[model samples]
Target: MSFSNFLSGLKEKTNELKDEVLKFKNKNFLHAATAGSALIAMADGSIDSAEKQKMLKLIENNDALKVFKTSDVISSFTEFLNNFDFDKDVGESKACEALNRIKDNNVEARTVMRLILAIAASDGVFDQDEKIVAIKIAKELGLNPADFEL
Candidate 1:
């Protein structure tokens, strides 16, 4: 009921949100990496060796996701990639879950989508399959695929 008490509570809530955003950023980066790699791999029926190597390097070098074992990240990405073969929709759903985790952080979803778009285009030509998946992911994250411009 007191003004001072309300201000204190507001500060506490803000701090809590900041902490949650930090955690969400980490999770979002991981998911974006996973989704990006999957799109590249599924681009041409098979993921090229060069693309695989790049994906692995990206995951290994990202400091925020360092908490995840190299093997764990690779395994998770691979699982999603495999799912892309049997069911593209399922693969997109998995990627959406990763993006959704950070949606509460407001801008984190868009940031993650930007990362995904960059990776999708890293191979020079954006593969059609990957582009489709990226658009699906962007929409799922409440982002505009038009922003990525394929």
Candidate 2:
């Protein structure tokens, strides 16, 4: 191949690799966000329509999450909810595991915490049960619950 063609191919390959890496990172974020949302939404023993709508709105407004389709986001959220429906203990364990993935990154952890808090208060009343779950999620993300006023 000519030098120009070789450079063009290399550039294309680099862009493809970059896109893959970005998608992987976003997927991790998506899982963590949805897991936190599910935990908070179910904390009070039920996931209300208000809570679901709040989460959907948050994802729609968040630049990082907006890259994903609404259906994809809903699917992820539903998957977490399904896990909880199957078994509370197992669901919590899996959700915490997902949150732990970003614990080392303080920024992402804080953002996730913020998202959790928003979901908790989405129904106009952040009750004790939701607070307790928020605290657990904060600890899982390596954040202090006190920082979030939980």
Candidate 3:
């Protein structure tokens, strides 16, 4: 490809990503989604490197989250992760509340739950602790545990 054509393609891809980001009507949805995923990552206690990568990968591929900037997602996840690390009681309470915001939107809530579960299983082992966290997140989102095979 010519230099100009390459630049054009790059610009087009950039615009597409920008449009996707703009398509996100509620930015809080991004925050809530990130927080929800972070909760699951910490469910098994400290998020191992592999688990962390899985969480990021899930967020990157989630249809509901793809509209967001990767950095934004990482920042939101960090905030929640740190909060939970600092104080499990207070942090979990806050994260759950944030997730509750999407309770009225079943589609969005389900998407978040699926993403969380995917992240939990990303390390190749969905342990008991991860399942517990997934259940809690499902409940917070007003979803039935049975729906997610919890």
Inter-residue clash pairs, candidate 1: none
> Whose TM-score is higher: candidate 2's or candidate 3's?
2
What ranking emerges by TM-score with the best candidate at the front?
2, 3, 1
lDDT of 3: 0.84
Candidate 3: misplaced stretches above 4 Å?
Answer: 1-24
What range of 10 consecutive residues in model 1 has the weakest lDDT sum? 103-112
Minimal lDDT window, size 10, model 2: 19-28
User: What digit string (tens of lDDT, one per residue) describes model 3 on residues 1-150?
Assistant: 899999999999999887866656756677778788888888877788887787778778877667777888888888888888789987898899889998989988888888888888888999899888889999999999999999
TM-score of 2: 0.87
Of candidates 3 and 1, the better by lDDT: 3
Error of 1 at 83 (Å): 2.1
C-alpha lDDT values of all predictions? 0.69, 0.91, 0.84
Hey, what RMSD does candidate 3 come out at? Answer: 4.9
Expressed as tens digits, the lDDT of each residue in 24-49 for candidate 2 is 77887888999999999999899989
lDDT of 1 at 25: 51
